[model samples]
Target: MGSNPTLSVFLNHMFQENSYEKIIQTAILTAYPRIFTDIPLSKEIFDELERIRKTESHGEITAELKVSKLAPELEARYKLVDQLLHKNNATQILEIAAGLSPRGVEWTKNPAIEYVEVELSEMARDKNKIFKALIETPPNLQLKEGNALNLKDLQKSITHFKKDRPIAVVNEGLLRYLNFDEKAIVAENVRALLKIFGGVWITPDITLQKLLQVQNKTTMPGKNQEIIQRTGRNIEKNSFKNEEEAEKFFNNLGFTVERHSLLEVIDKLTSSKKLNISQKEVKKMLEPAVVFVMKLEDSRA
Candidate 1:
């Protein structure tokens, strides 16, 4: 073989295959959540991601922050995480497409935080092995494998731990791979879970098509970076179009959508920063990508 190609170029090749999406997602499962290590679990989650992406298939590393995906923006995921977690009084988080990153498990300083991570069957195996080496107490944390749409699979996994508690659900980089039916099915399950258990923290992002049009893309590593470069994996994206549509989509599904963006959340989380954008500025940029914190409409003091 000739000299090893740069990792970025290799990733571009691997994603050209049929299972490129899975491979890319698995890579993201490994990366994509470390921007918030200010929270303790964020560091643990970051470490877990580092371990999982070490696979030869995910991609090669030419540069330090070589992975790529959505937002294509700065690492402000913590602000997103913090707002959702705090608003719901979230104690349990069921993270779907949770390859190996442990943000849900690692970011919580709230002693009550418990995370149930769900990944596909193959990634689950690697995730479990990595998870075992990373934690001693398994009470606040659990990782299981299954299709996101299968409640039976979720049920089996849920049986292993506390069955009765309000659980917040996390979905990151999941909507792109799911069709409308799949999305609806998962939403139904989330509704079922929250209705039974107590909470749902969902971020259904704009489609891949719409995301690409944005100017301030996060050059951050998403699972698909390698695949996109190699296999010509063009992600299909849909525009959120506008806040009205975005808000209506989730609202119909039973969540109260507080439409904000990464910057808004960052402003809220970081009190003192000259680099911070003003409220009007963040609100303006939010036209393309905004954050929504949803909770049960009926809940009241």
Candidate 2:
């Protein structure tokens, strides 16, 4: 399918045209090679991004936000998700809003795993080209252009899955951009898929408003403001008021939630030593982040 120009224009305006946050994230991971080791395509993609648009260095961006430890926090989040996927023994995975993530590429290395990465059309096209250039496109790794809010798009991506096996639906940084209503649509869509495929939905994007308030006072004072100014998304406004509210929101949608602290995988972060980040600092950086592994409430019975 071709790129959706209307949606592209809307997202460009929302994100200040050419300043998509994922590109910055890719740049940060690319800057610290030792920390985010496995993804060989990150650097190439970052270089391509720079050629396409002007971008500030990750160091300057992190320094401005006073979140120099963001890299380690990102690394921890990525690794913890992988750990949980393995723990769940999920062989079929669907990653929504896949962005510039290297997970599909790495996971598909094991032929037994079937990975599908869903993204907006433009990014899907860009990522497809990059993947093909860096290595032979694995048959198991399919990149589909789709929106999380649209169940039809999501259903198209899963057609390749074997209905006999449970699937794992995952997303890392998608929900913060959506308002409550949009988030509910995504939840419902995932619930529908789980009902059909019998799998769990894993996401770390269930941020809390209270946590943002606390971080604004301490670890990342101006970070939220900076993000709002850049992306036009008020994350605090979009976040659940607290953990209780977050849990209730999911529970109401018929999901059973399992919270996993990002700190659980702190020991696995190689960036801590390379970046000279102390344990105290890493803990503070990760304290607010949680990866929720959610299953249909009925599935637990």
Candidate 3:
């Protein structure tokens, strides 16, 4: 998406390497009720993924393998992002690295809000195909290809927004893959955008190292290990050392951080009932996850 050949090549390489993560996430969403049926082509995508996995893996891992509390955690994260978006009264929303998430489809149904879902080139193309095939594409929903590490790539999506209104920037599962330097670059890019169209950056992806270690060990040991091998990124290495360090990291980057516990949206998750996850289990699963709603420290908007 950039003129610089080296940068473009690097971005493409990153996308290609992590492409399977989207499929796994889509499969998780599709397996659960109230998620796949609500999103138009999610089930189809999951089925296709299953076909590919079966053919490629030779029955090593099937789509039916449950990844412990992953389904519920994802559900809670998705709902919590929406909750924080509404709470901040953000009508113009930009979701970075938005991979096959049905949030855009569902939110765009209300014409009052303008939603832009940005992803790397390949995933964006796939999402475009799904949208066009499933429904009459909503004018409010704009899908673009961009990289979070590059400000110019991110700025390209601004054309779809109303200039007079504040914009809320949201991302779910992006930051965990980045090391500290990459994260700072992303923070700077987002900070620059916030200065232009002032609004909150809502994300639940700011994970702590300890929390990630716990999840990896207990939640879905084998599955998480497989994902780690597939993606080739040490998630724990990319995570903050602790909650205080996470807050300090963002705060030092010119954003005032507000933490919203995932537990706040626990009761709203339908996956708990569908997956038969007890309240105790759900609470334990979600206890460490927090959605950070951040705004530029100096902004008066």
Candidate 4:
């Protein structure tokens, strides 16, 4: 697992934090669809997930409970992206900083969707090993190693897809770690991809600190603060000051944006396990988490 220099520091921090374990939980739940979501989960992948989970103690059972609490929003975001792709007649999906996400496996089940998952080399290699051991490779799902900040690397990885066909790029777990300059590079790369592929960039990245504070107070008190303090990572510095600022910033970068709250899609969530907080309280806490869909203004016009 060779580290992409640009992401090594944060990736190292994430590894230390056992954040990748959270991703494993996602894969497990995603494979056992009934556990968290109705999305189709493959048994082959679930077997692999179980194998990996046995090897690590990711804190306590409480950690998995936390993941369960957050799973709905993440799964909901994937569903929303799929809906947007269908609406736009898009055929290709590019997932940046994909981590151990099972999206490539899940989305590729639809033969029409070409899925490209980009990860830093080490994770890419490790995940590839699991894919090889567990499931046969699907024709449409491709995994490639690259840095999000490098456009040339990004283009090279997804070159199999026709530039004329619309491509929806999904970004998760990338922005929260980046500083402003790194973020600009990422935006520039996405802008370049959209310029060539004619589609949208979807992410849950444009959060505001005020909303997070309110969310923490209302529901998962001290949890968000604990993450920041433990990781020594200031999430506020990485996000827009407010929703209005987020809009203006992206507009300046040539994207016309639409925002959706994670809370809006809470109705789709159905979990068998009881959450630490009630659904209503969870909704209140998630007020700060939002999904942003951005496309080139010219493309939309």
Candidate 5:
């Protein structure tokens, strides 16, 4: 396989239970039904996932365990995203930092919707190949190769987008790893994109919550783990201390922002799934991986 360092960096961020939930979530919400199709994971992807279940290829131990929760995990995300799309009547899905996900293919089933998937140059090519080979994602579902930090690169891709309808952008599982300067620029670029193409979409985590697993502690490789593990690039999250700081900063950028905890969002999703688990367990899980889905008060904001 080709080397994709930025994709690699984001993937490591989700290499734990708290982190991996976002992976399960984005995959389910964006790709699940649209890409895999036929429910319960079509034969091929299911088999691949089954193989992954028995192998060490997925990630660390916690990641594997998190993968085991796929059904409920996916269910939780799908439940929320569908509601969001329905409530907002969005016409397109724009997923950034959307590293290696099946959602692009999954959501293509909706004739009215289109997906604009953006990623690092290396991953965009590989993912485009995997996604294109799996199924025809429609002229609507398009993939672009570029750097997330580079607006010109992102806009080159966006320029091709048929922006005649409402759009939803999922900055899921992003933000925490960016340095303050990079974060400011990216958030601004995204805001500019939203303003340029008006509509409501959600980017849940803004406080840039640090990954923490309670009770049982598993050491997940942090951002620079790749480099520390080998002679790799040292990319890490230069973060703000709390949600207030993130909001205060993001608000100044001109978008009307709202912040919610992972607990609040998960409870909403879990209730939709009707999963049986004590508040204690929920609390435990949310402590490490809290989720929040925000609606842009004004896409133009």
Candidate 6:
């Protein structure tokens, strides 16, 4: 338990009173609309997001300012998830720890896709109200109260979806908050889900301690520090020792894993004008990020 003065100082400044809920709030309410304007739901949710920001983080950084600072990195991560989702033909998506993300709201626009978003109790209740308020609520979209670590609740939550169709379980910004044991439990729960439906688990939640340590060595990597300190947790100790260990960890949990470089999609995003960040800047932000696509070995062809 040694202290790294660099990370400590940066964390204190950037994430003074942040938490997992606050981070999710920033992404869905702030970053989504501000950066990913091409998506229709992103534009539609602006007023609602403003209301949430006023109530959720009042007197803190305004949603616009916070998202502008986080725009490039956050948009890149979302693109990674969107890319991976398109890789599978699964018509059904079950997003865990869904927060207020507009993925379900947006994707349900296509009648073929059944998007189920699950969050813990209070968050689920609030989002349900908003989803209901929309003029055209997609019949295929659902918001439920479920915990990632609770197998029974997860099992019950997905009952509305067709039993025979495959399901892609998507999670982001959830695992880093969990300890090894908690992660393992979530893995088990996801494994069970795949066992039944036969699809993959898509996540960008895995982190490498080395990459973060490298970032901390630099003078102005406050974004990395904000991610770590927001949870009020020591992420270095929770993160994988290396990428190899991460693959092995999931492999032992019965997954056949594919690792995707989060930075690889930056060029596509920037070229499309969805991301205003430069290549040099995007490279720096992607230092500690990666996306993992986990399929049950048996599900693989």
What lDDT would each prediction earn against the true structure?
0.54, 0.75, 0.73, 0.66, 0.51, 0.69
In terms of TM-score, which candidate is strongest?
A: 3
When 3 and 5 are scored with TM-score, the better candidate is 3
- Candidate 1's residue-wise lDDT over 113-156, tens digit each? 76677877777776676657666635667767776766776766
RMSD of each: 9.2, 6.1, 5.0, 5.8, 8.4, 6.9
At residue 42, give the lDDT of candidate 6.
53
lDDT, candidate 6, 169-242, per-residue tens: 99877776665766777888899999998888999888688656645553125645565555465666778888
Off by over 4 Å in 6: 1-39, 43-46, 52-67, 133-135, 210-230, 270-276
Model 1 superposed RMSD (Cα): 9.2
The TM-score obtained by model 6 is 0.79
- Runs of candidate 4 with Cα error greater than 4 angstroms are 1-35, 42-50, 53-66, 218-220, 229-232, 272-277
TM-score of each: 0.67, 0.82, 0.83, 0.77, 0.64, 0.79
Q: Which regions of candidate 5 deviate over 4 angstroms?
A: 1-82, 207-237, 264-279, 287-301
Steric collisions counted per model = 25, 0, 0, 1, 11, 0
lDDT of 4 at 13: 43
- Candidate 4 per-residue C-alpha lDDT over 90-137 given as tens digits, one digit per residue, 9 for 90 to 100: 678899877656768877888988999887775677578779887787
TM-score of 1: 0.67
* lDDT (Cα, 0-100) at 231 in candidate 5: 23
**Models ranked on lDDT:** 2, 3, 6, 4, 1, 5
Model 5 — which ten-residue stretch has the worst lDDT? Answer: 226-235
- Which regions of candidate 1 deviate over 4 angstroms? 1-26, 29-74, 107-111, 160-164, 204-211, 215-234, 267-287, 296-301
